[model samples]
Target: MTHILMIEDDPLILGPTVRALTAQGFHVSQAMDGAAGVQHAIDDKPDLIILDILLPNLDGWEVCKAIRQRSTVPILMLTALSDEIDRILGLELGADDYLTKPFSMRELLARIKALLRRVEMDLQQGRQTDRVQVRDLVLDLGMRQVTKNGVELSLRYKEFELLSLLMFHAGQAVSRAEIFDQVWGTDWLGDMRTLDVHIRWLREKLEEDPSAPELIQTVRGVGYRFTAT
Candidate 1:
């Protein structure tokens, strides 16, 4: 059974959500505040987390950052705030998916399943490659590690995945839609900004100068391409 931790303060929403997930045969855990949610995440190590943006003790952003620093567990954020900046901020902080309030149980369940499927696919593929090298960057596929010029780079989960995808398609311009479908899953409903944020992060870590990136180049209104020279 897949374990899911839901950190939501509102009992009205929480009760039905938990019941629905439980009916789907998921092992569900609940936390009413951000502090408790973070602690449960560290101690129990759930397969995925459903976090709310507003909480009593700590906010969801802080909780997301804290968990991300330690684990690569997939996170699905819930928020009443529909602002684009807030959504982008959650993605920047390492959220895998975002859902606004007044969401249906059907959509939420579908998103959760998509995320789980993506993680499973990555785990299965991890055994195929030992290492991939492009220019000065080396990716240890099995270990999910990356190094540039013999120096290790600290990359988040999505950042590493984005780099791996681009490196796999070196010398070819990969469309934004393709990248999104592969990396974030075909059911991804987030804005294009999520991909853009991850691309910026990869350039900052792998390129000597992020402003004028040579490795991952923009294809002018199309998508991005990796030039392995």
Candidate 2:
């Protein structure tokens, strides 16, 4: 059974959510505060985490940073804050996905399943190729590491996946729709800005100059193309 750690303070929300996930055949673990959540993540090593922004002891952002420092376990952040900046901040801090409060259970389930599926797909693909080299950029798929010009680059989970997809289809124009469907899963209903942000992040790491990105070129009115040369 897939194990999930949920860090939510509100018992009202936590009780039902855990029960629902349990019914869906998931092994659920709970943490009422961010500090405990961080500990559970390190100790339990759950397959995925459902983290809330509002918590006692430590905030969700701190917990996220702590987890990212140690593990690459997929994270889905839940927040009552609707501001785009908050959402972007979470993404920048390495959250795989984010959802606002008042979200339906059905939508939440879809996102969870999508995130899990994406991880599984990545692992399966990793087994096929040990490494991929394009110009000065080298991707060690098995190690889930990337280096540009012999310098290792720190990439979040989504960023790594985005680069992997582009590299897999090097020199080909990959449509925005195809990328979203493949990376984030077809069930994702979130804004497309998520993809835009990830692309920018990839450029910053992969391109010598993010302003004049030559490695991952944006195709006008379409999506992006990865130029190996």
Candidate 3:
């Protein structure tokens, strides 16, 4: 069962969200304030977090930034703040997704399902011993580690998935649409620029020269190809 940590101040929302997640076979832990929520996340190491913005003691954005400093656990922010700037700030603070108040329960379920599906796929792939390497770069799926010149590379969640998929389909040029479907799910309607941002970050980490990447080549007008030979 996937365990979730939810931090919210509103008693009404807190109860309903927990009950809903529990019904979906998820074990949930609740924290009424940001400090406790961050602590619970550290103690429980939950599969994901559902955090509220109007939290007392620390507030959601600060909690998110602090938690991200310690772990790369997936974060989904729930906020009454509906402004685009507020949403983007949450994302920049290391949140995987942001949902505004008055959101449909069905949509909430769909988002959770998509995130769980993506994580499960990546976890399953990480447990397999078979791996693919290109030049000095090594991807040991079983160990869930990547290495370049025998030095382990620390990649964010999305970065790992992007590299893993590229290596899995070595020579094929994967289009942006295909990447979106594979990583973010087919139903996701977020802007495509999100993918580009991640790709740019991934290149900076994996490439000797991000400006002129070699192993992971960007085919103009098409997509990206990982040549691991």
Candidate 4:
């Protein structure tokens, strides 16, 4: 059974959601505040996190940012219905997916299953390759490691995926949509911020000048393109 960490303040939604997930053979841990959510995520390392944007102590945005800095664990944001901006912001802050309020339990279950499957795929793939090098930088796929000029770089999973994708598309621009689809999967319903956050993170890791990155470039209203140059 997959273990899930869910952080939401609503008792009505939380109770039903927890019961539904438990019925489907998921082992779940629940929290009502962002601080607790973050602690539980680090301590328990749940398969995935279902985070609420309106959390107490720390909002989902802060929680996501804090988590992204230290871990690449997949995060699914829970937002209020009609809060499209919140959905987009959550993605920009490194959320892997978002489910608006008033959504069906069936949909949430499907998303959880998909995320767990992707996590498994990433772990399996990590075992297949310890490292991939392009130019002077090295990405250790095995340890989820990266190096710059022979020095190690601590990269989150999404950042690592960004680097891998760029290496695959070396010497050409890779569209933002392609990057998001490849990294987060096509089944994800979140906005394009998922791609944007990862691309930005990758730039900060691999580029000497993130503000004017030479490796990943914006394509001006289209998407991003990455080259080893």
Candidate 5:
């Protein structure tokens, strides 16, 4: 049984959503507040988390940061706000995906399925002992950690995925479309800017100078290419 932790305060939304997910054969755990949500996430170790932005105690953002610091579990953030800043911030904070509130059961389920599918694919595809080294940066596939000059770098879930993909095909121009399909999945419903944002974040972490990046260079008409140093 796939365990899912949902942290949502509104009973009306939480109750129905939980029931609906249970009907789909998922073991659902519910939390009405952000603090309880974080606790459940840590103690229960769910396969996925559905977190709402507005909540009592710590907000969803804080809860996300807390969880990201410890675990790499996939997070699907639910928000009433549609601002671009909110979406970008959620991504930066380590959310795997975001869905706006007032969504139908069909849409919610689709998003959940897509995220779960991506997770399964990620787990099954990688080699157990694979390690990629480009210059001073080292990515350990088994451990899912990146180190620069022997120092590990803190990378969000998507950031690590994006970086790995780029480094795997170093010196090749990976098109934007190909990258979106590979990293975000073919069923991705997010904005195009999502990739650009992730790329920028990776550059900030991996590059010696983000303003003038030497590694992970942008192709004029294509996408990005990670130049092996």
Candidate 6:
């Protein structure tokens, strides 16, 4: 059974979520504060995490950052802060997905299933020829590792997938729609800014100057193109 850790402070939200998830047959672990959430994430290492942004003891951003420092566990952030900046910030802090409050339980379940499905697909792909080298950067798909100049990079799951897709089609302009369909899936209802955020993150890790990236170049009016340059 897939284990899920839910870090939510509100009984109104937590109670129903736990019940629903349990009914769906997922082994659930609960935490009522951000600090406990982080500790549970470390000690239990759940397959996926449902995190709330306005957490006590520590905010969701801090908890997400702390967890990312150690593991690449898929995190889905829940919050009432629905501003575009807040959503982007959550993704930047390494949350894999974000959900606003007043969301339907059906949508939540769908997102969880999608995230888990993506992980499984990635695992299966890892069993194939998994290593690809573009210039000095080396990506080992089987190992879910990326290294440049022999130094490993700390990339979130989406970041790694984005890099892999771009590198696989090096020198070709991959359209935004194509990227969304491939990386986030065809069912993705999130903001288009998600792609831009991941791209910036990739540049930060791979380029000598993210402000003037040479490897992952914007194709203006289209999408992005990756080059061995």
Candidates 2 and 6 compared: the better one by lDDT is 6
Reference-based TM-score of each model = 0.95, 0.93, 0.81, 0.84, 0.95, 0.94
Query: CA shift at 45, candidate 3, in angstroms?
Result: 2.5
- Clash counts per candidate, in order, are 0, 0, 0, 4, 0, 0
Residue-level lDDT of model 4, residues 1-229, one tens digit each, is 7888899999999999999999999899999999998999989888889998898899889999988877778898888856666667777677878888889998988888777777776666543445567778877665667777889887667677778777766777677667666776766655656676677778877788999998788888667776665
Residue pairs in clash, model 6: none
lDDT string, candidate 5, 1-229, tens digits: 9999999999999999999999999999999999999999999999999999999999999999999998989899999999999999998888888999889999988988998888888878865448999999899888889999999999887888889998899899999988988888999876678898888898898887999999989998899999986
User: What C-alpha lDDT do the candidate models reach, one value each?
Assistant: 0.91, 0.90, 0.82, 0.79, 0.91, 0.90
Residue 211's lDDT in candidate 3: 95
TM-score of model 1 vs. true structure: 0.95
> Of models 2 and 4, which has the larger lDDT?
2
Clashing pairs in 4: 130-141, 130-142, 173-225, 174-225
Root-mean-square deviation of every model: 1.4, 1.7, 3.0, 2.8, 1.4, 1.6
Write down the TM-score for model 6.
Answer: 0.94
- 19: Cα error in model 5, Å: 0.7
Residues 1-229 of candidate 2: C-alpha lDDT, one tens digit per residue: 9999999999989999999999999999999999999999999999999999999999999999999989889999999999999999888788888999988899899889988988897676544677889999898877889998898998888888889888988899999999988788786766678998999888887777999999999998899999967
TM-score of 5: 0.95
Q: Is candidate 3 or candidate 4 better by lDDT?
A: 3
Which residue runs does candidate 6 get wrong by more than 4 Å? 126-128
Model 5 deviation from native, Cα RMSD in Å: 1.4
Identify the runs in model 5 with alpha carbons over 4 angstroms from their true place: 127-129
lDDT of 3: 0.82
